[model samples]
Target: MTIEPRQLPAAQRTLPAMLQRQAAEFGQRPLLRVAGRSWSHADAAAAAAIRAGALAQCGVTRGDRVALMSGNRIEFVEAFLGAGWLGAVAVPVNTASMGPQLEYFLANSEARLLVIEADLLQRLHTADLARTALQTIWVIGEATGSWQPPEGIRLVPWPAGAEAIAPAAVQPGDPLAILYTSGTTGPAKGVVCPHAQYFWWGVNSAEVLGVGADDVLCTTLPLFHINALNTFSQAALTGAEVVFESRFSASGFWPSMRASGATVVYLLGAMVPILLAQPEGPGEREHRVRTGLGPGVPAAAGQAFFARTGVRLLEGYGSTETNFAIATAPDSPRGGVMGWLRPGFQARVADADDAELPAGEAGELLLRADEPYAFASGYFNMPEKTVEAWRNLWFHTGDRVLREADGAFRFVDRIKDAIRRRGENISSFEVEQVLLSHPAVAACAVYPVGSELAEDEVMAALVARDGSVIEPAELMRFCESRLPYFAVPRYVDLLDDLPRTENGKVQKYKLRERGVSAATWDRGPGAPRAKG
Candidate 1:
């Protein structure tokens, strides 16, 4: 059954309250299954209490930041809920974050403690711990290899609960998590998400998919992002079960869903095309998955996926900083456009001056929620950015979209330099920072190029130092260690100089128009090469 947000009490909108209420209502109903461990509805609150006690033993208190760096696992959920239960903010670091990125997130959020997987401890070798506020490190599993903690920092095995602690008096408007989103022209910004925002996320997403009790939702996405984290809220609110696969495997996706007995699946736009690329088999139609949320999916690819797998993929528009503000239902009139504006949300296609554009015109998509705390409070520790984004009392989406006369919103393109590749947001500024660090590169401009998969591919145009030669293979190896695998550039162009405006700023639009040329180096096959 759909969760009606209006009917929920103010207290019930917080994580601690939701866990307690669900425990009483659902009892032994399965709430989560991940990494071979299961948590029943009753176990949710119990585990959270135990974890909260453990956090308190480590000197964590209300409003303190606790960062979690791990993949899909029971311990990730434990740390996240524990922080929420204690009225502390949980900072989920992307598991793919390298040392530089990791240090930035920890420093920016002022996380007092970090719970990281044992395998990822080596990443700290590159991070400057002294720069951050972190004092304690709880390592899950055996810490292997020669890596050791720096002085003034405590490193120990994951601690056990000292005693069951009562939930902190957390309000719905309190910050629950600080999720970092890539910035266009600067470093990543931490989005301060209130507890009530997630409550509405669950309510609206469940309503869109018609989620009900007894249904099983499975997601192969990582636990760090809103897409996967929101699954927990969906289950708790509806008394449904959720399964978390450690990672996405095209060959193993169907088999895993069948193994988990998933009725509802979550997928990104790129995942649908990848799944359809695999060899057809009975496994596609053998699962019980009826529907899925596939945002950013091309209409053709979504239709093909549904035809082949018998699972209708719904398109929607949402970001880390917003709730599920727009979505398509099964009965939506059109297939290509992002569904109409969701309840409790106001949307507008406005120009640079914030004036609303007429229907059939393209402009920035601006949004504001009527419900209190339904949108992220603002970018954490970024007052100017918050003011810029929330100016005119509407959150500027930085996405160019067209509102059709029929009220459907069609995506145009991103107005920002942020690139979306394989469901991950890659910051051009961040990538350029890394590229500029290399001694061989005198100057560089990173931008997105269209991919056949209907997503963006990372590409870089570079001007080598006078005495240096830029080798594509060598540059790729350097990027692999510094940037996430997905953020590394796939194509590189050796340019004499980047096109520039009269003011000498890099004209990236010209670079984008130039696209792939004969002089460009392709790291992989099937990339279209331009004629000489």
Candidate 2:
């Protein structure tokens, strides 16, 4: 049988236009299913456009920045596309962030408007928006009993109907979204993606995966992340149905995939381990899932996962800045490696000097897209950082890797001090900052340690204040109170002084070399250390 991939209309080259075309072509077809109700393409598109019109009427004009804070609900999709329809950039705030983290994101993004879920609206009350230039706040779902908009902030109900409005004519290079890279560094850098960048993402992802109208795509990855926005958006371009869950649940994953009749699903590295840990059963292989996409599956785990689940696991390497840089073909020789570069994309391994290394040598991964739309425009409001990242006209991914003989790439390690545990990138700098807030923490260094279950585990070595007694349990509890659960150090080592260079920088490489083991950890001053 001859197979010809569907083509997007010429007029629908941009996101808003593509969404409009999809609405017209698949009016009666299922576009989104949430809770229990399924919204048709026409219904979803019309609602989004109406919301866009309302936002425009409320003074959110083209190029305005709008913050979207919501869980995985229909409202997120609507607000996202709605903002896109008005040529506004949607800043999808990570719902998991709390207090100062949340405050910093909203303020730093310089959002003019906030469309937030009712549950999260209360957070705005505590935020000092007056210091910033926020103008309005809109509520989704029902208003919380204790929630009220701050002074000068207007509350607009979600799903309210307004007249359809046309989107501003946007160039392909115009900013589409500002996705904050999960703090892998000091603070999350806002990766500025362009409309054409994402459009090309959807198109290339569809081409690589061969998604079609018959495919049902399920995504548990938050819509706020690029993995979902680009990888899952391919479903829309192919006229396929997309099933979204607000959050990932291991017990419900297989059952939901079966129920939705999903043929394609996105998997995070941590997700595979979680699923494998579940009770072995006949139902594991009883789903219609064809392929799974994402990164961080060790070769052994990838083989076992595929053998047990009967799903073809396709691993790909990319970031919020660039989508689908390297993708594993269905029949690639390397079992678990991210396959060769896709069409119009170039990958080179570079040393510390930014010179290309030999094919078999390990070094930093630098990517360049031959096509105009495949690369990011730049980092938002950070010209120096943007230029630094694109030095030598290549997008430098701070990830360490090695390219194999056949052009396939193998994951080596990350050059940056970022701990990727449970599929979440935790910045060591951020965690160290939280640790330093404690009175007992005199000095500290955070780094990634190998884990049997996760991609990596967070370990912290600390120096207590002179003449002060700080217990590991106490420090852990303090971190739990101040930071997200993922950022809390799994293991803590108390020391008189941390190994440092002559310049006073802690030698994290030595800590990683020594590694964290059950035998090496100090539970506390008196508590017994638990064996792993």
Taken over the whole model, the C-alpha lDDT of each candidate is 0.91, 0.77
Query: Model 1 off-target regions past 4 Å?
Result: 1-6, 525-532
TM-score of every model versus the real structure: 0.97, 0.92
Q: Write the per-residue lDDT of candidate 2 for residues 155-261, one digit (tens) a residue.
A: 77764767888777876777878887755556777788888778778877777777877788888887877877774468666678888876788998888888888
Tell me the deviation in Å of residue 101 in model 1.
0.7
Q: What is the per-residue lDDT of model 1 for residues 1-532, given as tens digits with 9 covering 90 to 100?
A: 6345458977789999899989988999999999999999999999999999999999999999999999899999999999999999999998888889999999999999999999888878889989999999999988876787778889989986668899999999999999999999999999999999988888889888888888999999999999999999999999999999999999999999999999999998888888888999999999899899999889999888888988988889889888888888898987998889988899999999999999999999999999899999999999999999999999999999999988999999899988888889999999999999999999999999988788998889999999999999999888877787788889899999989999999999999999988888988733221110
Q: Looking at candidate 2, what is the lDDT of residue 266?
A: 88
Clashing pairs in 2: none
- The clash count of every prediction, one per candidate, is 1, 0
TM-score of 2: 0.92
